[model samples]
Target: MRNASDLPPEAAEASASGVERRARWLLVLLAGLLVASAAYLLYARGVFEPTQTLVLVADDAEGVSVGMDLTFSGFPIGRVRRIELGGDGYARILVDVARRDAHWLRESSVFTMERGLVGGTRLRAYTGVLEGPLLPDGAQRQVLRGDALADLPRMVNAARELLEQLKAMTDPDAPLNASLREVRQLLQKANGRDGVLGVLMGNEADRTRVTAALDDVRRLLQRLQGVADRADALVQRTDQRVFGAQGLADDVQASAREARDLLVGLRATLQRVDGVLAEVHGIAVNTRSATQDLDALRVEVEATLRRVDGMILDIQRRWPFSRDAEVKLP
Candidate 1:
């Protein structure tokens, strides 16, 4: 290798110049890379994105810090940018919400800070009505704090009360124990000679009375069955007498036929009587001129009247009931 001292001065100067130029170019490239990386980091952090401010007031901000996310539906929508104690002794949390994600919040949005038993504090936002008016920028709202540890004392008290109730239940003099004793006595009674009846009737005397009553009911039912059988026989005999051959129904039919024949004969007799009455009326109208024919007409009327009397007597004989009948000449 040739030493630099043995080279010409211009060549050495040119070599030095080339190395400087390369070093300058490398520095320039590194500077450009640094600027690009910074720009990418700023973009990723959303430093240039348009945002709205939301102020949440809380009584305490023990676990909340700047850079904490305000989540909506388990997704981060805003970031806490500042926390300050207000003059009214409240902790005010200022959040920067991206303009795009701010639409997820509404006037009805509720913000909460929750500190769980096994995890870090979480900030959450809930919007119930999507159609509500949008939350304006720089709107100050109250934040609700939910701490699992805060309910420890109340839960402990409730657990103590439950344990006390269990202790009282196990005591010998407790109502539950007394009830159990009564149940045991009832079970013993149910297994005794009277069985379940003894338990229901509450005493041996009452059980005996109930048993006697049940036996009486059974005997009465048997008597009623015997009575029902006798009634059925009686109904059979009545049916035979009322509707059998040569029974009351047959006699009634015969009487009805005879009565019908009598009615026909009586109708014919009434027609003959009507003719006689007409002849009499004619005689009465011309009594002077018809004096000789009057005796003949009277004889004819007497014959018709005799026939009517015979028909009435025949009707009275055929009928089931009889009445005194007499024919008189008018």
Candidate 2:
């Protein structure tokens, strides 16, 4: 703690020089550290990195400000650098996207500014197709704004309406309550002695009558069913007698075969008769030739006999009862 005046002149000068040199060195070190820190901060902020400019136009930029992140798929790829009002009274937000993240943006990319109920406003980019054409530098695009608070009134109104409806439904005189009461009454009626039948008939006496009528109908149906069963049995017996192994169809077929055989035999007999008639005609011709005066009479008699034979043949062919009809020639 000696005073500077109590020191020797030379010693004091040397001590002061040393102190000046140390102070200068300390100042230099501090200046270097400050420069390094500033450079690190600039690098971290991506100030020197190459980036592309994107301008987003919006109707309102209430919650959007400079340094706000623009996210893609929840990752920050760009940051808002400036916000200005346009001539059309719209907000123009300028964003600087790093060159590496610029590839994620395409011509069809969509940008949105969303203000939620519980969080700060978010600026988001959506790229549906990565293979689409690249978005050029300084591209100006419209941003869709979504504000959750904008629909608050409508949602409140809807909720109020729902509450009112719930209150009305809870009222004793409400239609829903009335329907519930009717259903409860119906359930009580169903639990009565006649059960659902009493509920349907509306009265105990009517329910009893309906039950009796139902029993009567059931008995009548059973009787009719029994009668139908008997009729079916009779019909089955008749069917067995008429259309079983020795059926009427088989008998008729046998009779038809026998009739066909008779017809064949009759045809053969008719052929033989035709031959005998031919022989008779030859004999008549010979007789007529031998007796010239009786020729005309023989011819007339022969014609009449031919007509009678034809009539007998026709009757035999037409008559179903005369199956054994035979023509005997003299």
Point to the candidate with the largest lDDT: 2
Please count the clashing residue pairs in each candidate, in the order shown: 0, 0
Candidate 1, residues 1-330: lDDT per residue as tens digits? 999999999999999999999999999999999999999999888889999999999999999988999999999999999999999999999999999999999999999999988989999999999999999999999998899989999999999999999999999999999999999999998998889998999888999999999999999999999999999999999899989988899999999999999999999999999999999888878787767888899999999999988897877677664365443437
lDDT (0 to 1) per candidate: 0.93, 0.95
Candidate 2 achieves a global lDDT of 0.95
lDDT of 2 at 12: 96
For candidate 1, what is the TM-score? 0.62
On TM-score, the leading prediction is 2
- Quote the lDDT for 253 in model 2: 88
TM-score of each: 0.62, 0.65
lDDT of 2 by residue, 1-330 (tens): 999999999999999999999999999999999999999999999999999999999999999989999999999999999999999999999999999999999999999999999989999999999999999999999999899999999999999999999999999899999999999999998997779998898887898899999999999999999999999999999898788899887898899999999999999999999999999999998797668777878999999999998998987888788658865657
Worst ten in a row by lDDT for model 2: 321-330
Stretches off by above 4 angstroms in model 1 are 1-38, 221-330
Where in model 2 is the C-alpha error above 4 Å? 1-8, 213-330
Q: Give the distance in Å from residue 112's predicted Cα in candidate 1 to where it truly belongs.
A: 2.2
